[model samples]
Target: MQTESVKLPRLITPLIDALTNVVVIENGAIVKNTLSETALTITNDMPQSLIDSLFQSDNPVVQHNQKAAEAAYTFKITANRTLEAPINLFIIQKDRNMSQNLTFIVGEHAGVTVNEYIYGNDGSTVDYVSQAVVEAAGKLDYHGIVNLDAASISSINRMVSVKQDGKAFIKTAQMGNGNTQQDTRIDLLGPLAIGEIKTVALSSAKQEVLIRSIIEHKAKHTEGLIEQYGVAADESFLMFEGVGKIHKGMSKSIAKQHNKGVVLGEKARLDANPLLLIDEYDVEAGHGAAIGQIDEEQLYYLMSRGLSEKDAQRLIINGYLHPLEKLLENDIVKKHIESLLENKTA
Candidate 1:
């Protein structure tokens, strides 16, 4: 129940103003929370070595966010502890560009859930980076929603690691009339680790979006799943790239990726790429991608039920994105998705 707010001096005074808010609660009581510009205020029991390892990632987006970050938040769950409720993070941008970083660590035998929401004004830009690590037998569930105004830009990057017997689930929904680029990477670093990533995006009004995801299996008996769904309208462009890789020594590992997209307008464009790079002989890996316009048969069936063309199209799009909503498991997020769909259809 601890709430804190921070304001950072922007590099460009007239164009960007940085602001952040954070809240942390444990066992129905406020534990520790502070907001600052110069340093991250974290009160957690995780080891220093575990925190340092997250910064070693080589991803370009991660590097960019880290280099430009003006505010940071870190959350750690004690060993064998379970959070009663998910940690909620809300970020808002007014008229400026901003960069922020977030880190989550789940100790051995602990379980935690986190939900992040980002909203910004038109013409604004935001760069966000997040890293999460689940220790041996730990569990982590993360859900995110991005909603920026038209003409704005958002870049989101995330990295996750699962240790021995750990489980991690990441679900994201991106709904904006602006441009967005998101990259997420999951690493299975211990035996029997499990990871799942699901993302749904809706782009319209000349917006351009790129969603890239990678799942790496570096340990034996690991399992991973990646799924992406997107819809393009009004000349908007969308691209989805999913990559699954199994190291040479990783045997008995299974990885799968699926990417699908639908075009809602004649000028809309969609590109999907599902790739599997396996160096192990005893691994099971596969990928599939499908990009095309809405199914005419489905549309006809919906129209026959007395729905208008616009209504029918909306129904189709909803069906396509329904799976992602289920994965999100949040009523607020589901309402946001419905609102966005209404706007897009209007």
Candidate 2:
């Protein structure tokens, strides 16, 4: 654990005040962690059964990440307590391959929020896996940002389970300067459970980015929603895929999926795929997708106002992605996201 000092991303500067508890992972190992007085507990020790059960996926990359992890952290929030501050997690890879695993357990009636930042240097690769379990009546908010250099590659896999009356929100902002793939799945296992997944992805240069999210409703009165927005420029390729599934006997369940994308360069490509698989007749399920270029009229209108062409284009792109910032409650974080979007557009 080399804990001297590490360069932090600009997006995290606005969150310094609330970063009383911070975890830093470097080169696939835990380098430093600072904890404060709170209802949340962070530990590296967990039951083997729990770890195995949470990482049951058969994907080769998933198994590799689990087996290659040099350090793993589990965050447990006490029951009936609400965390007023968000936990910060930073993972950095420097010119090498790295893998890590994280787990979040929210006790019954408890509420917590977590922000994760994954950064990679040139020629580096990183695989990050996380599992979140929300007990009955518990609430969880998870946010992730992935930013890597042009020569790097990133893979993120996330799984979430919500119990009866539990709620979970998963939001992600992915900057596609390299090759990136995100796979997220949420399962509603008990009655009245709710799950939501929202993502904003930006790709430029020759980067290729893919985001896939799936929400499953397994109990009565359960609900699931998935929304993804993407932008592609400079010959890059971007794709957003969302799936909503309602299992049999899940009466009164609801599932919805929406995906939208924009293409900025003549050679850039964008794809949106929304799918719904419902096995219950009493459930309501729907899916929609839209993919196109920016509105030329809007660009013209902005340019006519004495703004440069690049400025006009950036403004329009920012407007398209602005809605994603509303999903967060903290203004500083929202501003950070806005700056990220602005930088990507520029």
Candidate 3:
């Protein structure tokens, strides 16, 4: 598909420029697929057996979405290669219900980065399912951005499996203006595997948002961590849940979970749960969570400095989310996230 013939959204234009490879899925169909300057293969079809072998899940939503997907895609990275550029995958849902499934395969010793963005419009509903498999010594860095229209509804499920010495780093930023449920799971299936998941979210205007992340350490010397931060305002509801599990006989494995949330309005509700399950006495596991409103003293101090109440609130919200910039490699994508937060808080 020609890039010129298909118009791109204004909010995503800056990010597309920074990414060398781009794929666009609109209304449950592939509208544009462009590839360049990246050592990756993009395909629309994969054997059912291959898909079943790479991904396994008991989540009903994930299973249903996988079977009912209107568009399915696979992105395969070359073995033993390190790619400096990130691949951009954009999904646009407008005026209709849509389901999509995406799979990513990282070959042995390969390193790759992926950035995915989902945008909804005209009260559409979206079901998004994704699976990733990392081979031995492979590394995958993934970032997901979810910004939907005020009346839209979305359900997102993502799963990953890492082999020996493989590592997966995942960070997601959700600007919630509608109803959204997102679930993520990572399994360290081989010795010395590592997984880390982080989330930054903002919910406002009566939106209901829930984000859950789970990491399982199934092999000796494996490590996993989950961290989440969110802000809720204007009668919205926000929940963050994290789970870390260390299986029996996985000696020396480590699992940790942390979650924090802030409430900006009296009616806004925020909840967090940090859960850790350990079956091995030799492993280390810990979990912690905190949920509260913004500190009144901090707001008072900022307002005393001649800042308006709204401006002070915005500054505080920015401080909570600005840490995400360091985790992102692309400056354009970082700025895009900042803009989204700015608009959401404003």
Candidate 4:
């Protein structure tokens, strides 16, 4: 007999129009083949100082795509009212010299789904970037969960843009300790556009994670997919770069990437690079990666079903981070990510 359920959080709505206007720029540049866009709705009650360009004063912190996560925050939206799910942003840095920068924008067919979590790492060490632009048949689902504890330092980067038959989905889950470091990225263009990205990471003692994923397939039936997984222990480290490209007159484009890693100890480490570039050709791209440890017949079938391999590897690394928290469509950001994964801290 085991019962403990008291879940109630599922009320997400936004899209109140008064026509719409929101423009935020700092440490900026948006002029490349510009169609000029800056709008927002939801009863147009803006002006929270657009996060003051993330505490401006010229943002910096580059080196492995850090660029100080510029803009810090310029949250915006447009398209009257209608957001039945997804929207929870939290960044907590309990003193010790903290910093910030965040940017968010939505327009076109206007649909929203976003959940971002970045817990403090003892301050003076947080650089992030969150960007999304999906118009046309607009749709956006984004979730980035990061938890750290130790000396400090954390870096995160995200980018998504799909016009035409727009649809973009991205997810990243990172948990670290032992002196942190995390770098991530994603990009996909338009034209019958569609994209899906999933990521998971956990590095114990002496942690490190560097991941970069770029999928750019412009036009003609564009589609992209990427999946990332990881687990590491003592002296932990991981680096992955999965890039897919198809330029000129991309026809019937298709791209794929997969990365996996598992290392328990003995100075754990992993590096994977999946890259494919095609100028033009009825495209079909591919990439797969793997780095491993921990599979003694799945830890002797979880100690012969008695449950104990440290709770069976923490139930297989939280079942690969519970499917991007079921693609959070709000529900109080899925109960604050189910109370931060039942207080598992990651």
Best by lDDT: 3
TM-score for candidate 1, residues paired by index: 0.84
> Residue by residue across 42-105, what tens digits does model 1's lDDT show?
5433233654565466666666666556666667678888775665555666667777777787
Q: On residues 1-346, what C-alpha lDDT tens digit does candidate 4 reach at each position?
A: 1012222111111211111221212113211111123343222121234323221222244322223333344556675333554454545443343335455556677777666656553433666555566767777777777765555676665666677887878888876452444444434456788887778776666667776677777677888888788776668677777777778888888888888877777787878788878788787878888778867798788889899877777666566665576654335445554454444323
* Candidate with more favorable, higher lDDT: 1 or 4: 1
Q: Which stretches of candidate 3 lie over 4 Å from their true place?
A: 1-10, 13-19, 297-309, 326-329
Worst lDDT 10-window in candidate 4: 10-19
Rank ordering of all candidates by lDDT, starting from the highest: 3, 2, 1, 4
TM-score of each: 0.84, 0.90, 0.91, 0.33
| Per-residue lDDT of candidate 2, residues 1-346 (tens digit) | 3433343344443454455567777775676677574788878843357658644676789877676676677889999998877777777777677777888999999998888878776777778888889999999988887877788888899989899999999988897478989998998999999999988899988889989999988789999999888889888989888889888899999998888788987999998888888898998888888788887898889988999988887777776665356445566666666777777766
Local distance difference test scores for all models: 0.75, 0.81, 0.82, 0.59
User: Residue 71 of candidate 4: its Cα lDDT?
Assistant: 30
Point out where model 1 deviates above 4 Å.
1-52, 327-329
Q: Tell me how many clashing residue pairs each candidate has.
A: 1, 0, 0, 11
Pairs that clash in candidate 1: 16-96
Model 2, runs deviating above 4 Å:
1-20, 29-34, 300-309, 326-335
Task: Tell me the lDDT of model 4 at 31.
Answer: 13
